[model samples]
Target: MDKKEILDTLKAAQVYLSRLKSLDNELESAVKQIINTFEETERNIHDTFSNLKVVLVNILNKRENFLLEQAKKAKTDGLAPLEECRNVISSKVVGTNKLITQGNSIINGSAKDGLAAFSKNASLLGSLPEVPELKEVPFISFHVDPTSDNEVKDILSQLGEVSRIAPIQITELCEKPGAILVEWHSVENDDRLTDIQEFRLQRAFGDVIKEKHLLVNFNDCYRGLDTQFLVKDLKVDQPYSFRVCCKFEGIQEWSPWSLPQVASTSLRPFSWKISDDFLLSNENKIAKPTVDSPKVLYSDGPQFCVGHSVEFTFLEIDSSNAMLGLIDQILPTSSSLTSTPGNSFLVDKSGKIFVDGIEKCTRLSEFSKGLKVCFTCDLVNDHKVRVNVDCNEKRVTYDWSIDPDYKMFFVSQFYSPNWKILVE
Candidate 1:
């Protein structure tokens, strides 16, 4: 009951209070994390279900409309002949009845009247139309199975249990020409599998009901951790939806598919057929026009259609003497490269835009590595040409009048291994 005893008791109380505070802080942190996880799970599930509902409804509606249209058309066609036959039969019956009535009147009339009636009956009989032959109209029958509802119910019952494995999180999706790269991460601290084994990537493109789904497996390539998979051989500029799932080495069941990621592949490179007017120098990397050769390399693809543009991506630009333009006439192989041909529109590397060997615009742009230059020929609008140069995140465009009678080509009179271009 002295001062030392009281101080000792207060110190013990303080230690207890500090421990309780630490426990409370830990509990709050755990609660917040759990709440966040639950919210994410709920959102994902709801979104998936909603999307599935919309897709199913759309499919069902389309099928219903198609079948209804078919049935309606069949009904209209089937009834047309039947209606015509009915009208013909009705007319014949009326004529026969008239003839019968006239014959009866003649039998019951006096001599003069009977003679008149007999003539009338004869006329009626002669004027009657011939009975047309009735051909059988084929009937359309649509069969409906009464047990289909039960069959669907049975199939639904056999879909098995909902997977307990956490869904994959898509981290990155890159679209390239003829290919797509999909990267994903599994749920952290997932204890469903002791060691990760394999992952399955599935993709659906075009009409879901018609297109065959694609499935690729990454077994040894992935060490059961977060990784990426490149899907190749895909059609360019086609939209595709993808999902991922995983399985343990010893487990039989695979995790449920991840949320769908939809993207379209990049446009395919232009089908460029290099002409022999230019020599392939520097290990066939650079196109150089010789002095005695035509300074033009034409593409075998179709001419620039209306609103269709051509883009060139420069991987390397070692020379600034390149010329891009359209030519109306194919110059002879012995033509000199010093003068631009007539009926041509050329853009040179020195920022000179020329039309028919005359300077049109001096606002030309230089090229660099990883730069894209696009030329759009607007033949519909008085044969105008629009040139767009994209470099270093900057773009510049120039508009110039052009001759519609010319074809386009790329001309360069230099040899450099670092001068490569891709036409898109």
Candidate 2:
């Protein structure tokens, strides 16, 4: 019984196992097929969704690209006016640069080109509006008169004898005997606004005439005064031989001197018409002092005959302490250096001037700044006249009363009065 049962159970168990195995295999296969089917459906669905999303995105991008391309084509077609605008901007830049260049040319060069063009057309165009002709030239005038009896002779004697004095020159247009005029032709032609007409003259007494203080009493209508001149104080009174001279400004050159004319003092009141000798018309014995001695009369020197050069000889009195040459030039001081001839026309005589503190040099220049007296003879005429002179290295004259008794004791101590006159 056990065997049979065991066989049947084994068979039953085998069959059931076989069936189970087959069912398990079929179930497994079926599950696998289902899973595969499910996965395949999911994959298909996912692929469709992805394809749809891509199509949507591609449509959106195509719309944007088409809009951009259309806008680009519109811009290209509309560029003509923009091109014109760019050209206008560029033309403005070029015009600005041109204006700036023209402005700079005018400023940097002071508009010289414009001025040159104007000058070329001046005759027809006339001068620039409101502008006047340039008148920078100078006119000079000289006046000389010696009609008086002794005035003529006195002045002539004072003018040192020269080989040839410049002939007295007068304006050919207005020839006046008493008044002499000179023109600095070079300066006149170059800067003149008009022809010089008249000049003022100042007068004083004595050698101071060399100082050249006389103002050129000329009219300004002719032209402007030339500032380019050797401006110096000239003497007014006394005697002088003046010649008009001129020099071009900046051109360091002097024109030949004009003909010289004699200037002498007349006792009469100064008159424009009778500008020269101031003739007294009548006369007397009283006269302006002449060069007869080395001492100045009126006791003191120089003031009276300012432009006169003096070689006073006061012999050294061995017994007297008369202290060097004491010059009290008694001439009354009426005018100032510029107003009227001052005390005298004297200059520094270096060491030669010192008489107990006064000037004692015999060789006194015309405008002797200091009264100079040199000891050559004894002074006797306690009361004598006076002489005048012009100073410095120019025209010179002397005024002194030298005693005939030339030899004196001043010779023993300092002998002949030295000849020394130096201008500082």
lDDT of 1 by residue, 132-251 (tens): 454555566677676996886686567444444455666778764346768988765767545667777776765332343433321222334556866655677777777777887687
Whole-model alpha-carbon lDDT for candidate 1: 0.59
Candidate 1 positional error at 354, Å? 2.0
- Candidates' C-alpha lDDT: 0.59, 0.35
The local lDDT score (0 to 100) that residue 220 gets in candidate 2 is 19
Any idea what lDDT model 2 has?
0.35
Candidate 2: tens digits of C-alpha lDDT, residues 34-77? 67656855786678768867986898799779777876776675
In model 1, which regions exceed 4 Å deviation?
1-209, 212-269, 275-295, 336-338, 379-418
For all predicted structures, in order, the TM-scores are 0.35, 0.19
TM-score of 1: 0.35
Which parts of model 2 are misplaced by more than 4 Å? 1-4, 38-64, 74-79, 88-424
